[model samples]
Target chain A: MKQFFIFVKKEFFHIWRDRRTLLILFGMPIMQVMIFGFALTNEVKNSKIGILDLSKDEATAKLSERISASQYFDLVENLKSSSDIDASFRKGDTKMVIIFPEHFRESLLHSNSVQVQLIADASDPNTATTLINYASAIINDYQDELMGETKLPYTITTQTRMLYNPQQKGAYNFVPGVMAMILMLVCTMMTSIAIVKEKETGTMEVLLVSPLKPIMVILAKAVPYLLLSIVNIISILLLSVYVLDVPIAGSLALLMFTSILFIITSLSLGLLISSFTASQQTAMLISLMGLFMPTLLFSGFMFPIENMPIPMQVISNLVPAKWYYYIVKSVMIKGLGIEAIWREVLILTGMTVFLLTVSIKKYNVRLA
Target chain B: MTDEKVITAKALTKKFADFIAVNAISFEVSKGEIFGFLGANGAGKTTAMRMLCGLSLPTSGEATVAGFDVYKESEKIKKNIGYMSQKFSLYEDLTVKENMRFYGGIYGLTEKRIKEKSQQVLADLHMEAEQNKLVKSLPLGWKQKLAFSVAIFHEPAIVFLDEPTGGVDPVTRREFWEMIYQAAQNGTTVFVTTHYMDEAEYCNRVSIMVDGRIEALDTPTNLKKQFNTASMDEVFLQLARKAVRQAD
Candidate 1:
């Protein structure tokens, strides 16, 4: 244990002394996080929606069918009570909610007046805004049909309300996306370079021949990167909340827990890359070309995964960053708890475990 | 120097698939002896050194370092031996003192010991004024000498050098041998592999490997008499002519 600390300290010194590595380790994450959070735009399709129909009338059913039949919306669930609106949003079961009055058909016949409400979780303002527009258009089409013969016009006033994000800030959607991309890029590229630097300079052979345990050597090498990645996470989160003005609506502790898990997954991927690469350049190249593109493309950060081809959609499931992006978005934007993001958390954990197993198997701790 | 053996091997072998890299080679090194391992490129000198250093597993036969079996007690063997390679060793980005303290610390030395030993190492090299400089800023000769000094800093029972002085001035190489002689006199067994025949003349006993086997091993004078040559170079050439493995 004493030796392990000493080794970790040495590893830290290596990181501190090299200017280029120091820049990539600390500078790149902060720059990318800020750049991406403020400037990136988001677009999404196939957003799931829920319907709360107190009347259960033919008119309510027909509107729900019209919304679901469109390519932009997927009617996923029926909310049994008004209370279920918050629960459905928190569980990520729906992106938007449509509520009908108790006697929609009766009220229209008696007074030629009724009301309909569309509530959206505006943490993702683009998707929320688009869904509201689509649903309002459908309700207006229904209202136009009823106005064909009546002089009163039987008005259906559509009201749209945003939950969680009242101001509909743009940071809500892409902050989590930026966090996933930065973590994946910085953690992976830094660690693989650190490990491969030893191999390139021949320090690894010296370390391997020492009395220190090979496992200890590997752990010592990874510990510094892990801690630095945590620091990056804290910086990104602070910037999002303070500078970008996006609040953490879920449990802060759970948010950190999931971020650390994702960091470990990226570090293990770095280790696997180091095992196959003999030079620091190769490690850095693989980290960039292999990890960065997939993360940006498949994590739904830069491109909407839903709008992709079927083969791409299937392939996106294998990207670890995709799940991490989902977890962060659910926790930070939708204000969801572990009950909603637990499956994503589990998937990240499983990827970390598998990556660690394969990397340890491939990593040559000896000179052979 | 006592005659107690610090390393023993009995037909230790290593095979890479169909190729036999080290085939049933056996040797022993007594304490305080400067044993030179001489070979042409691809002659399996490094493969044998790796097995003895507890870095590679032998396919057959047996070996021991510092009274511990190479197979079952490699960790212990590593604790008892120091290794240096010609390709590279110390962290170039770290200061000379930092590199010393780092290696010393990982060897389980205390803070005070690391400080004191680092000071002593710097003073011995007449480099006390340059201790704070990064190793990359130093010249190649000084770096090699510092690497050799740091490798044996833990006072391990045996120090293994895989061509420690590959490219350097002849004067610096001579100075490097003086350091090895001083260490051997202080009761540390030195096991070195080298391409320089003159360096082999300085070893107390030299082993010539050709094609995965030790073709000849004896005192320099004895080897000269056995090979019927005037110097170690002709002795190497006469034996190396038998090698069939192509050098990379």
Candidate 2:
């Protein structure tokens, strides 16, 4: 045990002396969390909109005022003629144009409806689609206010309540996803590169011939990374709570335990890669392509797993990050306990054990 | 030491899938003797050395290092032997004293012992002033010497050196040999492999490996006399000329 501490200390010295590695280990998590928290978001806000109110009536003016009052749209301009819509879009001043036809209130009062044409720039289809929804929602609210006590014959009014995130903040979704990603990157990628580096430098042979057990050598390599991964988890969690205001609804201890399990899973994966790779470059390539790419695309971080193809959904089950992301969301956002996340915890534990067993077997076979 | 054998092997071999890296070859090294394992670049000297050091396993044969079985008691063998790989294996980012402490700690040396041993090692190399410098800042010869010193820091029964003086100048090579002789004189058996034929003459006994087998195992003078050559270099060329395996 004392010798193991010595080995871990040596490993830390390797990390400490290399300024670039230190930067990557500490700086990458903060940068990734900030990027996912602030930049890469699905929520639509402050969309620039143009209103062409040809009706010039009380009801149309009230609708325009309600849309502008909502946080979703900035209400960039009010155009006189319909021809001005093209210029607004061309100047990038408005993302959506709302045209209210003349006699809008008279038509709604007598017949029951009026034509409110919503034209949106489809150049960025996602933002355009979201903006159109926001505009329609604002107009619907305005109509509801206009219909004070008069109930429609058969109006299917739908009320949506964002369950976990009340305000529909993007940080709630990203905090967990970023945690999964940063843990995978720091533990799996960095550990594999460190082991392969020792092999490339011929130091692995010396370690192999030492009194230390092969298993202990592997543990010694992992211990420093494990500590660093914990530090990273803490940094990201602190950033999420303090900077991004993403809450941890479950027990913080349970969240940390799950993070530790995921980190070990990643470290075992790295050891497996290091067992087969002869150089640091090969280790890095395999970790990035085999681990990071799948974690990014298939882990349900940026995309929904259920929406994927059947084959992709099946493949996603094998990605540890996918399970970890779900677990993080359940614990931190959904406020679920161990009962809700036990299956994912088991799967991650199974992966860690499987990778560890396979890598140790590979190491032994190679040594023989 | 009364002809005590530190290493004993019979028909040791290593095969990589379809390829036989080390053919069944046998040799023995007495205590405190400088046993030279001379071969061309890919003559399987390293493969054979790795097996003896417990870093590799023999496919089919019986071998013992420091009186431990190569197959089952490899852990015991590991504790009793020191190895210096072909590439000087020291952490470039770590200072000389730090590398010493790391190696010593891994080999189960006590903290006080590591400190004393490190000071002694630095003093012997006349590097006491530079003990805090990173290994990358040192010259190649100095790094090589430091690597050798660290390899034997645990004072193991057998010290294995694989191409220890490959790229150093002649003077440095001679000085490195003097260190080897000093170690051998202190009753530490030195098992070394090298491509330098000139180093073969300094060994108490030299084994010339061709392809994957040791073609000749004798003193340098005897080898030259038997091959009817004036130097060990010509003797090696004559033997390597009839080799079948290409240098891998």
Candidate 3:
């Protein structure tokens, strides 16, 4: 235990003395969270639309007014003819073109029917789909207001409360995910590469031949990273709450407990990688390719796991980060406790144990 | 003095898959003696040293280091031994004092002992003026000397130097040998491996390894007389040629 503390002190000196590593450990998460929060948003607002008002009637004018008033669409261009529709889309200014057929109001009133053409730019499929849905919903609402007495046969209403984030703030989701990813990256990859660096510099042999126990040496290396990762978690939480206005719906203590658990899982994975690789470059490549990519890609940080293929979903179940991501989202966004996310917590704990056991076993085998 | 050898090995072998890196080699080194392990590149000197240092497992033979069985009490033996590799293994980013403190600390030295020993080691090496500088900024000779000092900073029973003076100038190497002599005088057994045949002359007893086995083990005078050569270098060259000829 005394040797372990001394080794931990050395590890802390290494971390505190390296400026560049310090930056990557703390600065990266804040930068990533702020960038992903403010710059990249899914909410579609002020989308430009080209209008071809062939009817030039009161009803058509009322519909256009409603579409412009609804914050989703902006009237950017008045196309003189149908031929201009394709040109407007190609120029990229107009995301959609609304065409009103000739005698549209007359047909709707006298024949109880009218046809309107809604052309959308499908270059970006997600934005296009959102735009179409917004336009459709607004038009349907206007139709309901016009025909107040007509009762629809079937209707479904979705009241999306978005509990913790009432406005569906992107930061509330991204802050937690970024925190998970950055913590994993810093703790696991940095620790693994640092160990491999000792090998590269030939310091590992010196340490092994010393009075220090191998297990104590590994713990010494991991403790500083574990502490730093906790600091990173706190910074991210503070940034999310204060700057991003993303509340911590669950207990702070629980969130911290889960974060520490995940940090251990990540650190153990790093140690496992370091045990297999001889060089810092190899350790880094393996950590990034094997751990970071899977953590970021399959852990539901950028993409929803439910939308992934079946095989990928099965593979994601093996990634410790996946469970941790779920745990963070549950505790932070859903305000769920251990009872609500016990399975995810259990998976993370199991992964931590399995990885740490494997790494320790491998280290012993190498020593032998 | 204790009537027990500090190091003893019988047919100690290390094999990697099909290749026998250290093949059935045997030797012994008494306590408080500067024992030199000599071989050319890939002659299995390092492999044997690693086994003695408890860093590698011997495949098919028995060995003991610091009176502890190599296989069973490897960790205990490690605690009793210190090692300095060919590479200057000190953390270059740390100051000289910091490096000493770190190595001493991890070896379970108390804070007071670390401070006192570091001061003594630095003063002994005449490096007290540069203790605050990062090790990377130190001269190669100084760094090598400091590495040696740090390896034995915990005052282990044995210190293993794997080519401790590999790249230093002859003058510095002599001065470094003085430090090793000092360590031996203080009753620390020195087990060193070197390619420089001239260095083998400085050992109390030297062993020549050729192709994973010790070909000759004796005092420098005995080896010279046995090989009918004027110096240890000539003895090594003749033995190396004879080994190559036999292989051919």
Tens-place lDDT digits, model 3, residues A131-222 = 66677787677667656655432221212222222322222367667877897899889999889889899999898888677888888889
Q: Model 2 residue A175 lDDT?
A: 81
What lDDT score is found at residue A142 in candidate 1? 87
TM for candidate 2 is 0.85
Alpha-carbon error at A272 in model 3, in Å?
Answer: 1.1
Task: Please give the range of 10 consecutive residues that has the lowest summed lDDT in model 3 chain A.
Answer: A154-163
Model 2 achieves a DockQ score of 0.72
Please identify model 3 stretches exceeding 4 Å from their true place: A41-172, A306-309, B1-4, B15-18, B242-248
lDDT of 1 by residue, A1-368 (tens): 99899889988898888778678767877787677655532233577899999999998988888988987788899989999988899997588999998999999878888999999988767778868888999999988887886766688999889987776644336778777877887778888888888888888888889988767887898899889888988988888788866799998899999999999999899888988899988998899888889998888876678778899999999899999999999988789999998899999999999999988877654444
Higher-TM-score candidate among 1 and 2? Answer: 2
Q: Which stretches in model 2 have alpha-carbon errors above 4 Å?
A: A40-45, A48-172, B16-19
Cα lDDT tens digits for candidate 2, A158-218: 2332222233322237788888888898899899999999999999989988988888989
Tens-digit lDDT track of model 2 for B1-248 = 33999999899999989988899999999999999998877889888988898878899999999898999999899888999998779999999999999999988899999999998999999999999999999999999999999999999999999888978999989999999999999899999988888898899999988888989999888998999999999998999998888887
Candidate 3 per-residue lDDT over residues B9-106, each given as its tens digit: 99999998887888899888888899998877778888888888888888989999988998988879988999999987999889999999888887
Candidate 2 residue pairs in backbone clash: none
Q: What DockQ does every candidate get?
A: 0.61, 0.72, 0.65
2 versus 3: better DockQ goes to:
2
Query: How much TM-score does chain B earn in each model?
Result: 0.98, 0.97, 0.95
Per-model TM against the reference:
0.81, 0.85, 0.82
